[model samples]
Target: MEFLQLKYFQTAARYEHITKAAEELRIAQPSLSKTIARLEEDLGVQLFDRQGRNIQLNACGRAFLEHVNRAFMELDNGIKKVKDLAGMKKVSISIAMTLPKILPKLLSPFLNQYPHVHFRQIMEPPSILKRKLEDGEIDLCISPVPFGSPAIEWKPLFTDDIYLIVPTDHYLAGRKSIHISEIKNESFILMNTGFSIRDLVDKLFNEAGFTPEIIMEVNDPETIIGMIRRGKGVTFISKRDWQYVSHLIPEKIRINDPNWHQMIGLSWSTKKDLSIEAYHFKQYVIEFFEKT
Candidate 1:
């Protein structure tokens, strides 16, 4: 029933280990256990299923945890609002993105103008970014793919054409444009499955009625480019990213299909009220894209 009890329960549910949660909470294990027990007694439901030292959140616990999260979020929002009104807190913006390489260009100028503002940038896969936005964990998300949730609003920032990259000495490197089907037999160095680019490229391959021979799967763009430069395999890259790697002088051939481009967008949760700083940054992002 107490705020502290709910906090303890939320932490315990997160880790599913009483000792670990107690350690994080900086409280004694026995005291934390007693607090959770009192909370369960007050609620008249068993929150966690226990097996010796192991603990699992039951269905009731999961349901209650959702409300507990919202309660904490509301409390945090209220505090932030009060501090903003009094001009007592520094401006802070938290953003999650799948494309972290684009941050320097966007953030540098914005920070130059508002030097006092603090930014927390996180790099996550598109799926995890969507969850983070919905959970009120991030103020905004910039991604190549839309979250497609009713509670989230997505605004297209820009679209970049995808190109097939290969070593300069490769036979196909002489081509200006090529259909995806023509390269089905070529070895591919691709991003891992969870990445947005990987999903987009996979869909393109699926639609083209061919599965590419992927010889390597990597998480870093630099590594993919390096492999392609070494004639290890071919891969895809966006036109926006081409500028960064063009100096390496790899062959960048355009995909013949018109739909091969990727749309990058900005997204925010409609269910959560944006902080003043977040609102300004959102508008700044929109304007930044417009001017570009």
Candidate 2:
């Protein structure tokens, strides 16, 4: 099979629409289709299921797409490595994170050391970040916890306490700390379901034996903090996040539950080739936490 055939098949699999994929690749729809057909024939498996004009990845296609993505990613990494070795290094590291606000502080030391380094940051939920890391779309991810993938290598950073935040005028605001069971009936403005903190909050509520009365689910931490300042609802905040806007929300009550804290860490692909820049950044992160 030709390399172009694999590339065409991957583009089609990504869009799952032959015409749209062709448009994106700047190729004719029929040519793209024939290329994919030839690839399927060579592989002896149907990559997609066609429903008239629409198409979807079949089981085999999904499996094949995984390998194709990694193959392209490795090829890209190889080119970058050669460029770095030739002293034409202009490294760009792609990163996805749940707590993006913390990244500036975390990366400052590394950036100070390597002024030539650049980053592409994607602030996404933990689930999506994990998927991107697994798919080799991003070089690394910073999240509360590691995903259970053999291809992923998780290095523990540091743990932080989770606070039950409320407005100063709220009824529970006077208390030094509160139990998870205490907040069962209160309205909550939490992060949306994809976040690691959201998962933790849901699990805490489940253990407390009642579902929270969620008023709104937000993606941004600043929005959640804003709502809390206006006495809208209560939500959990990591110690790191709370530090940034502590003056805005003074009622940072600790969660009395022992397991209420989160362990944030760096996760990278064990299978993908790590560029020199990514390798240095990973080491810097691990050592930074150690010094702290």
Candidate 3:
């Protein structure tokens, strides 16, 4: 079957509805349907079962999806590799991330070291990033992909020690660390709900046999820090993230436990091509961690 047809199928299966997939692909519904039908014909297999207006993948479709995904992934990798070699050595690193605490501090140094390299950073959650990285849509993801996914190669960057961001005048502001149980009744202004960091927070609270009050939820750590500055609530983030804004910390170390930390890392698609730039960026990141 044609690659475009497989793409159409993927979009359709993703939404589980023809109209939505057509809208996403920006194509006419009838034309999309015909293309899918042609794909099924070419493959000599029924990929989906139509139930009234809704569609569901069949057993064969499920099996073929894996191969189709791999095919496109390899194609994208080949294109990137060719571009890396032909282009003006402007190695473009696609990073889906939360702004790191050390980004600005390290960026000038990084640029000075590799002036030819260019960066395309996108701030997104790990789940979306994991899907894009696996699909070869990005070169390297510099966020926690969560639970060590097997589809991509994972490189551990560092153990991100957790720190609590409390208001400048909070009761815990005078202490170096706060026990997890001490904040049993305290409300938290935290990252979005689906984040791996949030999951880690839950696990920590669970281990302490307490649930945070959870007064507010936010997506960005900077915003979380801002909220804490306004005394809205307290939140936790990694030392790497904290380093980026430690000057504004305002004596706000709300650490409940000193030992708690999260591991952050880099990831790349195992099925894709690794351009020299991507390779160099990965090595630089690893070396940074090692030197620290």
Candidate 4:
């Protein structure tokens, strides 16, 4: 019934452990348990199924938690709106992306125009980025692939062709284009697994019917380019990424496959209300891509 009771119940449901939730809430365990008990009594339904020391949210608990989450989200949105109306708080936007390098290009101009606005950025894989959107933890997500969730809305910003890149002096560098099968035996330097690009390239490899002889698995794109420049190995990179490595001038050959392109886009949860500042940034991102 009380706001504190609902807050305590939300935290308990998240952890499924009274002790852990109480620890996080910085309250005594007994007090937290009593609060939950009172809440259940008022609601006239058992929310959690209890074991000795652990608890699980029952069907009723899960159903109620959905409404509780929406209630908290709306309260947070109301606070943000009031702060915006009063000009009492500096606007901040939280963004998560799969591609870290593109953020500067997207944010620099916008930040220059609105110097007082603050930005919090994070780099996460596509799956985690999707979850962050649904949980309202991030205002927007820039991803190479669509999250494909009914609760999330995605818009394609641009598509870039994927290309095979190798050292200038490599044997196949003279060719303008090549099939993936032709390079099946060649050593590759690839982005590590879990990266969206890595997953895309892996699918291409699978379609080509052979596993690439990977000489290195790297996390940084610049490092992968550095290795390629030294003739260490070859790799696949999107066309837009060429701007970062153009000076090095590694040989970029087109892949003959029809599916060798990636669509990068922005996504946000349909369930959460966007703050005025966050909404502006989202529009800025869309226009930024349009002009490019």
Candidate 5:
């Protein structure tokens, strides 16, 4: 019914979980629930089907979501245009990425050059990041895998090698490299389902004709490495991770397949025209990768 109510509805609908949406919106779960209920009542239709603690958007909700998304996007663009005209703080760029640690390296120099520029970083799985990018929730994204969306454009940054890592005390620690089939029965720790690396690892296992014996699904790479160090299991990591973790001396088992690597890159929506500052920042990232 109101502008803020639409925002609340959009957040709740995006996640399809009231509590999770509330947490993201920085509001109480009851408050979010009440807001959604008021919105549904105002529209005189059931937007979401309530099932215990979970919720799913129905057909009506889905249709309304598209309109709401576009409306907000236009409003944001107008506001950004006004800010640019006013020359207030060059621009505010919201970027989503799978790796939070890389933000400093990517933004530090650029921010130094344009002191008026501001940045908002969102660290999320590639799947969610893709959705946010499409919805115009973020200006651009850096991802390890392609989103496969026609509305989005992706540019290859670099090829990052994937490695199979094991605890130093594990039996396979002595091996320089190994096939996925060799570790079929070994316990494993992996990034949770939505992460691009997890998807690739799962596909690799499927191609090898075996399922990894997963023992833990976590969100943090550092924690996964810690678990592997304690002999909890093993996982596939990238060269970037290996750099941070080399001191641990975990055995890096290269996958036998030559193509067992991910193409890390930048992605942005083509639907919306970029502001001048955003365009320049995007080019900076492109050139930065080109030089590397």
Candidate 6:
């Protein structure tokens, strides 16, 4: 029988008296009896034994009631789970990130406040991250906005100046300040081409009228720091990223003259619709970094 019929049967079976069931359900006694009869016919089973004006459930009716009760209980549990998820008692967040330092500083605070929210993180370049946002692979991106796609929207989170990172005992490490042009002759550790910070470095070198002595290329800021650690080559990174290299921070950092600041932002797809949870999380990130 259908849910409605099962429901009517459940009520009638609970009372075990058609007259009382009809009164509780606001229906006529004959109508309730007819519905129950129709239900019994559909299931090909006799549900009750009638004795004058009273009723008692048959053995088959007792067994069916047990299963119906279980089914309704499961349905109720499933609905509760959906409600809890909507209320954020159970939540998930997906982010595309480019740098390690900024992510921990931003993510730690959120996780502390919401330990229940499941976190999913992916490290990707700006181009791939942008594509992920469009395809709904990532809910948000803490990355640079790529050129030529106005469909991406960015909320300026922070702008950090780039600093020259030299080996601890290197000559430039002792400098009070240096010019970008002076570093032209030194070997360099560059980020991969699609990264936005690389574009900034290239522009600075172009303006200084020299090519960097390209030594190595790596995807992440940490790898670039690793390269610098081995004296593979010097590199540039935002002040935010440089802080994470605490052991090397002592003498390796020197701000170049005419300090250039690249803006880091929280980016999401402008063309795609944002869910309430994603929208709230994005807003939280903006306000969180805005304080710093």
Candidate 6 positional error at 68, Å: 29
* Candidate 3: tens digits of C-alpha lDDT, residues 1-292: 5768889998998887999999999999999999999999998989999985589999998898888888889889888766665664577677665545466655667777667777777776677788887888888776655535677898877777777777888888878766777777778888887787887888888877877888878776677777888878788877767766678775546565645787777788887876676787778878877887
For each candidate, what is the lDDT?
0.87, 0.85, 0.77, 0.87, 0.85, 0.77
lDDT of 1 by residue, 1-292 (tens): 8999999999999999988998999999989999999999999999999986579999999999999999999999888776764557677789987666678998999877666678999777778888888988889988787878988899999998899888989989779998777888999999999888899999988888888899999878889888877889888888878877788856889888768988989999998888876887899999988888
Candidate 2 per-residue lDDT over residues 36-119, each given as its tens digit: 889999999998999854799999999989999999999998887767745587778898777777788888878877767789
Listed per candidate, the RMSD to the true structure in angstroms reads 13.3, 13.9, 14.4, 12.0, 17.3, 10.4
Clash counts per candidate, in order, are: 0, 0, 3, 0, 0, 0
What is the alpha-carbon lDDT of model 5 when measured against the actual structure? 0.85
Q: What TM-score do all the candidates reach, one by one?
A: 0.69, 0.70, 0.66, 0.69, 0.67, 0.67
* Residue pairs whose backbone atoms clash in candidate 6: none
Evaluation by lDDT, superior candidate among 1 and 2: 1
Q: Candidate 1 vs candidate 3: which has greater lDDT? A: 1
Please identify model 1 stretches exceeding 4 Å from their true place. 1-88
- Among all candidates shown, the one with the greatest lDDT: 4
Q: For residues 1-292, what per-residue lDDT tens digits would candidate 5 score against the true structure?
A: 7998999999989999998999999999999999999999999999999996599999999999999999999999888776774567457789887666667887888877776778888878877887888888889888786789998999988888899888888888878888767889998899999888899888877877887788999988889878888888888888776876688845887878766888888999989777777888999998987876
Measured with C-alpha atoms, the lDDT of residue 269 in candidate 4 is: 92
Ranking by TM-score: 2, 4, 1, 5, 6, 3
Local lDDT at 43 for model 2: 95
Candidate 4 segments whose C-alpha is farther than 4 A from its true place: 1-88
In terms of lDDT, the poorest run of 10 residues in model 5 is 82-91
Give model 4's TM-score versus the native structure. Answer: 0.69
Sorted by lDDT, highest first, which candidate order results?
A: 4, 1, 5, 2, 3, 6
Pick out the ten consecutive residues of candidate 2 with the lowest summed lDDT: 81-90
